[model samples]
Target: MASDDEDECGYFYDDEDADEDGVAAFEDDAAPPPERRADYTGFRGGGIGAGIAADRLCGLRIFVCTPNPSSFQIRKGGRCYAGSAAITQESLYTAQKQDLSTVMNLLNIKQHQARALLIHHRWKIDGICDCFDRKGRERMLRDAGIVLQENNSLASGGSRIPVGSAKCNVCFEELPLNSVSTMDCGHCFCNDCWTEHFNTSVKSGKKQIQCMEVKCPAICDEGTVRCLLFGKYPEMAKRFDRFLLESYLEDNDSVKWCPSAPHCGRAIRVGAGERYCEVECPCGFSFCFNCAAQAHSPCPCIIWDKWNAKNTDSENIKWILNNTKSCPKCFKPIEKDGGCNLVRCKCGQYLCYLCGGPTGQEHTWSSIAGHSCNRFKEETAGKSLDTKRQQLQRYTHYCDRFKIHGGSYKVEMEKMGPAVAQRVRLLESDLNLPFAMRDGDWLTRAHRRLLVSRQVLSRSYAFAFYMFGGELRTRPADQATLGVAKNLFEDQQERLEHHVEHLSKVLNAGAPAVHQVENLSKVPVAHVPAMPEAEVVRMKQETVTLAKTVETLCGEMYKCIQDELLPLLVEPMSIAAYRPDGPDKAKELAA
Candidate 1:
């Protein structure tokens, strides 16, 4: 593991002037000075905004740029991060360049050829190496749609034409050498045909265009295509360039476009096998990289999808159908607010609520006279309805708690976040305060723990909903074994919930109350009253201790899910492991 300033590229900065180019590296572990800390300008412009504060307040380690003091950069570390990074449109080229140069240098291939190989391997350099070693270089290159050397002799010797002209196989016309193009696959076609083919392929959303000849798998040379098409179709050529640029994300397994709306124009790249992890973008959007949904860890992506679908309009309809019966005559949904088995619809139609059968508007508590539907039916239909009711009740039990914690998270993020930040500024500004007390990272870490725990606590309910409620078809055959597992899971969930709420309470206690915040809003930073020294110590100790406890409990809960619960299932399912700092803020890649 590298230190925060070591810059995950396997380099250490012994001093500030490590780079030969004179670009100073950030080496400090502590945050920037109070005057230099980024202003929270609510996620609108490019400067460090609410999104960065959300990350900082939540426990993420952010390094304020020295050159551009106002800029904030998220350092990747902590549990389950796996070295993920953010690649903006401007930096995508840089990110791709690193990999391209690696493959190019290793194999001594051209840039375009290396790119094709990387795209075919989904940008896994290790996978490419493995294939190269096992299958030999030629086979590996051939598999990746590259035919660099083997057929070059064939193209020159087998296709020698009358010095100045060659017949294109596609158009079957003799064209001068300049007017025709020869592909690496030893196939020659008129330049016009190649351009049309390239245009059609680009329009069809194909990033890699192959040779025009049937049964030929060689990828057409990108430079040649660009040279031929740029003169006649500049717009299409640009679109072609974009397609190739965007392919680094679309074709690669380790990267994905950020799911932020209005197009953040950014893509996230993660270490291989880390696709299941949740990540937060610099744009202030946090999502499960695997599913592109709200960060719902501890719940598998499939379970989250199912839970979301279950909460849609269809569930409301199911609730209506369960509680209400359609009127016999009017066919309108009717609910029996209270009374005997007999009920009257607003349409003046009478029916027995139990069996939903029409009857004269009269009935006793035990029986309906005209409808002999008092007897309980033990048929499959009745069993099905009973099962549905049980399922709905079970869902409601988990969903209510999930929603409650989710709501609390939003409130705390919006209200407590700013309040804590303000307190941090106030404490830092007070010069008379003890140097130890001035560092407010403890409070920020504690509040971040609260936010992350709240999220985990909320999503844990969703996991339980699908796991124990039998929403998933896969379950252990032994009912007693499952029962024991459920108990163990719920025990962990209960403990996590308890400490999360406790942490939240402590954070709220440390932060100024709503009215106090309102009053502090109107006061100057220096004028704000400093928290008592004893109180500050107590709060710091309590918050830091509670944060560690919550972090441990969260890790244990995830262990219960991954190790204890998931293995019992016949079908495979996985959730991202817990990160105490919340999702690691993906570091923005630099060119």
Candidate 2:
């Protein structure tokens, strides 16, 4: 198996001067000290803020224009040996290329000092030439020997190409029918190989996908994933393409955005205006942009995935400028406000649907996605105080619902608190008083506990179900929530009967004054007639007091929740299991 794995060295860095450790081929003796190296100011203000990596100087063939004292002898086997400073890639390129001997010609670096800085440029810098061409360049970059694929494959972990240069998955051949990229897990079989695999999975009803590379979390690029595989691997390709087409038609134009929120996620979304439907997320967090819930449409946002992907643009700014009026990819309305006219798609696709133009393939939405028309309804929506007021009203509504839920639960639980306390007190009073030590105390204590449990649960249940109007909003009186409330009500009825039974003998005989069961309800007790209006009003007042007691108990529990339980919910998110920062937050609510 180890023999099957490819060597770290590749064609690109296999040159005569190419050192085994890529660093040795590129060290320069005469260079600036680390303290004087230039500070990183983010790549040309393009938003890709990358710092200069110090290790790079040792990896290239360095050339110095002038000699200086900063220059040091190369370390030969840990000892400094004088080696004349080189003036070109050719001289240093020869002495210690592709061997441990180059590292032996170590920089005259001090024990604690950082290595000297030589000429450095990012990959985009022009006129930078390598001894190897493009293909060779990619291959050399692969030899760093560490791959970050999630699935730990027995293979080279998807960082390196498959054994024997990865034949097409379908045809089992080396050359691809067209352009292709290996999965992150280094499963580099041709696209044809994967199309069949997708067909099998999708058919078996698997909705999620990751690399075939063991446990990789990396998702296949959905758009061309099928095309690449099917275009070459005929059998699986045809079946998979059919599935893809079906998916495309039923789908509204969805754009892929990053799932990371206003962060890196560029998921696929669809629709027009403040409401978008059927958003497909690249991070697998598909949900509606409107209502911020899961996507289920006929009622989708209808976003164009190709429109929002221009996360960083240099070459495609003009295309975005031309397509900013309406969405360029779908010819649908784009209602963004106050930005340059760049509208990148969530998917990789980038063409203007409005003028049949193309958007900047990689630009910020603000760069070119300026509002082009006077037609966005959501725009000028708050121009009227009434609309603004309504927006405020909705915000308040959601907040009020949440608060009412908490309050109602607390209030209900407080009612049981006093009952439980009184029962315990009554039991204690009777124990020390001129009365027999009753076994009934055990049953009373249990009843009190049972009451406390019911009180706590009943209120929270009501808040979860009824208070939010989730029950009212649901059809059939919101069966899911209603069922819970109904069950709680029934449980309370049963508990009342049970406690009454335990106190029955004492009630008929008349219990001791210290622990009387006189006023308590019992099944075997005599029947009572309906109360008059005044009596009903009095009863309602009693109910209110009982509710206050319940509320107090609820507050006590909430204190515990807030002080201890909630902190454990995690950071950047509450409850640790829900909300915006949570992984499933996008899918948690219904849109």
lDDT of each: 0.68, 0.31
**In candidate 2, where is summed lDDT lowest over 10 consecutive residues?**
110-119
User: Which candidate wins on lDDT?
Assistant: 1
Off by over 4 Å in 1: 1-82, 150-180, 188-206, 313-390
Candidate 1, 1-591: lDDT as tens digits? 123112211121111111111111123323334342222111112333323223322332333333333233545345323477899888986677666655554454555678899998998765675576578667788887787632354433444322367788778998986677666666778888998998898888777888998978888766666666676887777787788778888888888888999879889887655778888888989889889998889888998998888777576546644654589899988764321235689989887554567877543322433344322233523455677676565565566567667877887787788788887776676677788678888888888888888888888877887787665666547667777777777767766665675677677777766556767757777565678888888988888998999899899889888888887788788888788888879899885
Q: What TM-score do all the candidates reach, one by one? A: 0.69, 0.20
lDDT of 2 by residue, 363-418 (tens): 32234465222111234336665854544333333223223333333432343333
Residue runs of model 2 more than 4 Å from their true location after superposition: 1-166, 177-179, 210-550, 553-591
Model 1, C-alpha of 564: deviation from truth (Å): 1.1
